[model samples]
Target chain A: MMPAALSEATPLLSVRDLTVRFRSGRETVTAIDRVSFDVPRGRVLGLVGESGSGKSVTALALMRLLSPDMAEIAGEVRFDGRDLVALPEGEMRRVRGRHLSMIFQEPMTSLNPIASIGNQICEPLRLHLGLGRKAARDRAAELLAMVAIPEPRRRLDQYPHELSGGMRQRVVIAMAIACEPRLIIADEPTTALDVTTQAQILDLLRDLQSRLGMAIVMITHDLGVVAEFADHVQVMYAGRGVERAAVRDVFGHPRHPYTGGLLRCIPDFDGDQDRLVGIDGTVPSLTNLPPGCAYAPRCERAQDDCRIVVPDLEAVAPAHRAACFHPLEFAREVSP
Target chain B: MLNYIARRLIYIPLSLLLVLCAAFVVLRATGNPIDIFLDPNHTPEQADVLTARLHLDQPILVQFVIYLRDVLRGDFGDSLQFGGPAMPAVLDRLGATLELLAAALGVALVLGIFGGIACAVWRDRTPDFLISTIAIAAQSMPSFWLGILLIQIFAVDLRWLPTSGRGDGWHLILPAATLAAFVLPNFVLITRTSMLEVMGEPFVVTGKAKGLSAAKLLFTHVFPNALNPILSFLGIQVGRLVAGSIVTETIFSWPGIGRLLIGSIFQRDVPIVLAGVVVVSLFIILANLIVDLLLSINDPRIRLG
Candidate 1:
């Protein structure tokens, strides 16, 4: 990990009190509540959480891809210096896929089935870079090659249905990086692929990040992925940030009880655990969350204070913070 | 692809044979065509001669065998009323029907697809509500009633178009619009449903994330993906329009094959009636073939097979 002082300079993307609420009929549910984090330049920030933890919503909000009538987002999304939340949609369109791009989950359904692979990749090139048809076509083939696709020139003329799941994902990655954006938000990018393919995709992403020097907000539920790829990590529970720290600090000295529970749940093949430990309950519904803390009911170290009052995320160690009145003590190193 | 087309072509003759048999059986059951030529002045011997000369005196099976042989040799007997070969007379009227069909189809496609896009894009809003309501109303209305209504409003009251008959482009407005109204509702409903489903697809969001403008995303991404269902529906509509035009053509007194078929049926003109049926069915079959080809072109997933 980089030294704290060296990584403390202005982040490439800084989100502050970012909130997203979805309105249906008369009721409004907060999907993301005052969530905040920073993605330093040329670094990966893993936003780890289970399903419905607002990770995907946070990614879409950052890109302003959510429909305004359904989702109401408020707060700051400062990218490189401009307040993206305040940027007009017309101007924001220019920033998206040019300076800030995204990679989505489920590569099987994320591409236009009717369009040729070449055309899909060329779309972003021509739209953002204003390249002509021939130039875009040439660039698209190059991008396919960049993603390590074999016979890139021939693959360009094929459709999504003609390619395998892993190959399609490579195309999606190529599209995301067409303009060499400064940051890429990858939301569960490998969740739909098989074990070996997932590893290969992650490896490809890591290689591209290091080579291109672009920041990434890696949103995933797999702690193994975070440990392997993310430089900094933030854990979320029921739409709120639960803990924030460097990857080593999070795994070595987990401060939040929820975070401790998550760590214990990861199966240890070498340790001879017969069964994996599991968190006791499901995530609370966003529309009907408890008054004090959403995770208090399922937390092992829940106290009266935890039940009655929600704890704010506070500094527990240097560059580490956890939202708990009784933060876990640094007992042992558990890096796997 | 060539093999697929050849396979599809093999089925046409078999279908046409079935259609011809059904037409022959139905017309024979409707009473002898010779009876329509009879009067009080005819003697019994003269009636028998008339029946034998027209080959109506033979058994139904023998008559069908002879009719099938003649049809295979490219021979449909002269029209009993018009005194000419039935095939040419029917083919002559095909141009008018095709003209009306083309005009109505053009109108339906433009209005239905755009209206559907508007409805899907503005889902749950005033435009969606209004367009859906109109589509439902249009779908429920009968073609003949709608045709008359158009004539009364545009031709009678406003005097903007002719009341009936085929003439210049001005004369086509009422009939084509009426025919279009019959199929337009289906187009709107199908397009709207297909478009709505596609808009929710992950690729659409992918397009949006690529910084594509909303219009580009809709036309290039959403609309093309939604086109498969619409194209299939268009095939069915073409067949319906050919048959449904009988009513519209009658209302406008347009000199199309539909009007000719109606006139021949009343006159008990068996040759002309059979010719009209075969011609119309052939058109429908060819239309379905074209639609299938277009579908394979539009979506590469459908490899003609």
Candidate 2:
């Protein structure tokens, strides 16, 4: 509808102040507190966070998948020039699977056990694309082949339990990409898989992203995955975004102490170390988070100001941002 | 699939043999049928003649062996009360019982499944509260009391249906409704619970994310997975319903196996009672087997196993 130049300049997904609060009895706990980011067209944005850091909640909110009875979401999620936050449910559903899709963590439980893989893959094609039964089946077979599943035709009639874990995940990916969505939200897609399978899946996702030019929001707790796959990185702590920058900048010039702690937690295979370094404390409970920065309690750099007031996510470098008053000044090189 | 069915079919006769042995021992332990069957003024010589003729005078083990041989030959001996073969009499009443059972099952499944799905879909809302309250109340009410109440309302005052005695479809209304009322609650509760659980499964979320309509998600995904537990429960309910029909049959005066079994027990008609036990037990066993088969077909995991 608009001029082509402005549309080309705009990111594929632009999220601003996305907040999610879950209600239990009388108390309300904010799971995602005013987090924001942008994913440029065809780029991969890594959302790194520990458990309870609101990564999954943010993903579900973006998709409008969270149950309204349990969660209250407020924010702007502008995707492809449409206001997704304010879209009606019926309209949102149309956006889902057709233009925006999601790949879940546990492929074991993601697919319907009773349904054939073919039918599962065919569902979205038939739903959004309006493909007939025979057409859907043919498209489904092509999709299975695209995901690198062996014997795609025979595998179509196979149930979930008949397939191995890796194959099932491939089938799930096949389903996710069936309609050739413009964006895919992969929430820890490889966490449940073995190391070899994880690499294969990442490779497949990377290959698919470039070939299809679909923006990807890769949500995970693994920094290694970010280093390997993401072009940009956003680090979250206690339901808030603490750092946002390009993958190379965030890794080389680690700004937030929490982000540094995460990078250090990964075992150094070349170095002489007896044990792996872990962040000292657990993520604070959402209902009882500190008034100041939620990570201040666990941060070694905490000061009087850090305990008294929260710091806003401000630019540290040209594009790098971190929400910390005492961010590291010097850049430390870390090769991917 | 055929191999699985064959394996199950092979168990039927072995299970029936075990039932027959238990029945023979328990029936003999109830005391000789001669004492209850013979007239009080009958001569001692006449009683002795009857006992020997019926094989009651022989050792229990010898009588059991003779009984097994006769049963293997499809001869259940004569019903002392009916003065006919007990098997035929029991079989004759089976059709009526099966008819009542089918009607009652139809009523229960239709109302119960729909009610359960409603309760689940509208869970924690006014409709769920209302349906759950009604289901609990219905479950608690005895079948006989319900039958009597239905008779009072529909037959006595309203004059819409016959009060008792099985005849045409009109006579079936009250008894079948009563029997169904007792079981319908179980179906509602089970289906609701199963549906709730299945609706929470990850595949359901996947279905939702696929932008499938709510009804499509429910019918194609949730209901199918939920069906396994409901089917298993249905198998168990069939056994209970067959036994439960005794009270309903007696109240409604429906000439079913339950009524026949009740009359035989009261009159100490050993042959008829034994025949009824074997037939009912066999029916329950077969119903359970069919349910297991259905479950295997419905779930691939179970099928492959």
Candidate 3:
């Protein structure tokens, strides 16, 4: 990661201590607990986590799409000096799709099968921009072309099922950027695609982000994705952020034990003649999380103090933070 | 596509065979049409002459074969009661009957879909509750009884519409409304349940994340996905509506196939009765084919890869 002086710019969006809990039967399950992060303008923030790590929850909370009956949320989401959580629903709705939009993981069902691609893309334009039908449709075609779909004009009449999976995902991306939002939160955008298609989509996103200069929050469980594109990385575990810093620092230093364990889980073809390693145990059940440090039972260096007290996210060095009792100094202690 | 059409084509003859077999067995088992044809009190000479002339003296198998052969050649025989060829009379009445059926179904479909949408969108609210309760009540009530009540209110008391007969265009209203009511509830329940379920699917969630407003989400995303059930239910409902038209048509004195069927039943017009049954069955089979074609047009997943 580049030094702070070279990258200094006011962050575009800021999130703090965001917690979401759902009540089921007689128990309250905390899904996202005290997760905080920032999205610098024109930069990519990768939120890497395993399933049930609250990465999706954090992204959804950004748009206030949580089921009203099931989940209760508490957090400060400051976007351009405004508290998004405090915004009225009508205002929030206007802000959504126009200012903050998302590209969902699965393009298959995300699209309306009956509607022509034109109508689906032009929907937000008509709603938010108040564009008339003709203008909206024209813009929809333009967006299709912008997404590199061939024969944009003719494709407008076609239904979603007419297109392949990769094309549909591109159509979804076209819709996501239809309003030219400042932040595009793509939630595992390639999770449902083949590897070759995944690579193509990732390239498209990076190219679009570079050209358009929108802040992107790339949420994924794939460390490889973060390593490739993310300017900054935040590793979340048990509904909270365990490590956050410049991408290189987090991977090169990897202060937290859980972070190190997760990194080891990703297969390294560049080194090691052996088979891939793995982290033990599934994600802890949200309904019955352990006290203090949620990852303590799984941590290799955990001791009596680590078990008793949950460590706070503290700065171990400039612009690098971790929630661990002992930071790994393997690189510093061992000569290259 | 050709394979599908071929399979469907084979069912046509296969269906006709089943109908002919049923007609033969049921007509024979109920009462010998010959015995009914000749009065028992008739003199022996008269009965013998009638039996020999009509080929009643022939074996049952021979009679069935001859009857099946004539039917295949489009000769439905003469109506015993009407004193004319049964084919022309049956075909003429079929046109008017089908017209009424089509009109009634149209009314039912438009109302049912709109009502279902209202209920699904409003769900558990007053409009939804009112529409559902009314539809269910209308469904549960006998169409014949409901038609009688309608005649009593709108025809006899209020004198708003014609009371009976297909004398004027106004006469079709009461019978059509009654039939529409009968078909309404099934479509209402099916469409509403399907729409609600589709609304809960993950795609709808993804749609919301894309910032589509509530209205677009309902009409475009939710309603279209909900169309499959409605299409499937259409075939069954049309079949039932045509079959159930009998009592309602009789009650309202509507000049439809159902009324013709009843009149033929008392006259012991065997050819006319068989024609009526065949006509109704054919319509049902055709409606199912139309529904299939519609499904293919609406959903790509149904096609063989």
**Residues B164-266, model 2: lDDT tens digits:** 9989999999999999997999999999999999999999999999998889999999999999999999999998899789999999999999999999999
Which wins on lDDT, candidate 2 or candidate 3? 2
lDDT of 1 by residue, B108-154 (tens): 99999999999999998999999999999999999999999999998
How far residue B280's Cα lies from its native spot in candidate 3, in Å, is: 1.8
DockQ of 1: 0.85
Write down the lDDT of every candidate, Cα atoms only: 0.92, 0.92, 0.85
Q: Candidate 1 chain A: worst 10 consecutive residues by lDDT? A: A1-10
lDDT (Cα, 0-100) at B245 in candidate 3: 84
What is the iRMS for every candidate structure?
0.6, 0.8, 2.2
> Over the stretch B1-305, how does candidate 3's per-residue lDDT look in tens digits?
67766777788788878988998788888776667766667787887787776677899889888878888887877888787888787887886688778878998899999999999988889989999999899889988888889999999999999888886779889988888989998888888999999988867876787666778778878887898899999988887898678887788777778999999988778889988888888888888888887776777556443
Residue by residue across A1-336, what tens digits does model 2's lDDT show? Answer: 336798799998999999999999999989999999999989999999999899999999999999999999898999989989899999999988999999999999999999899999999999999999999999999999999998999999999999988889999899899889889999999999999999999999999999999999999998889999999999999899999999988998889999988888888888887897888988898989998999999999999899889898989989999999999765565432
Lowest summed lDDT across 10 adjacent residues in model 3 chain B is found at: B296-305
Rate residue A270 of model 3 by lDDT.
67
Looking at model 2, residue B248 earns an lDDT score of 91
Predicted structure 3, TM vs. truth: 0.85
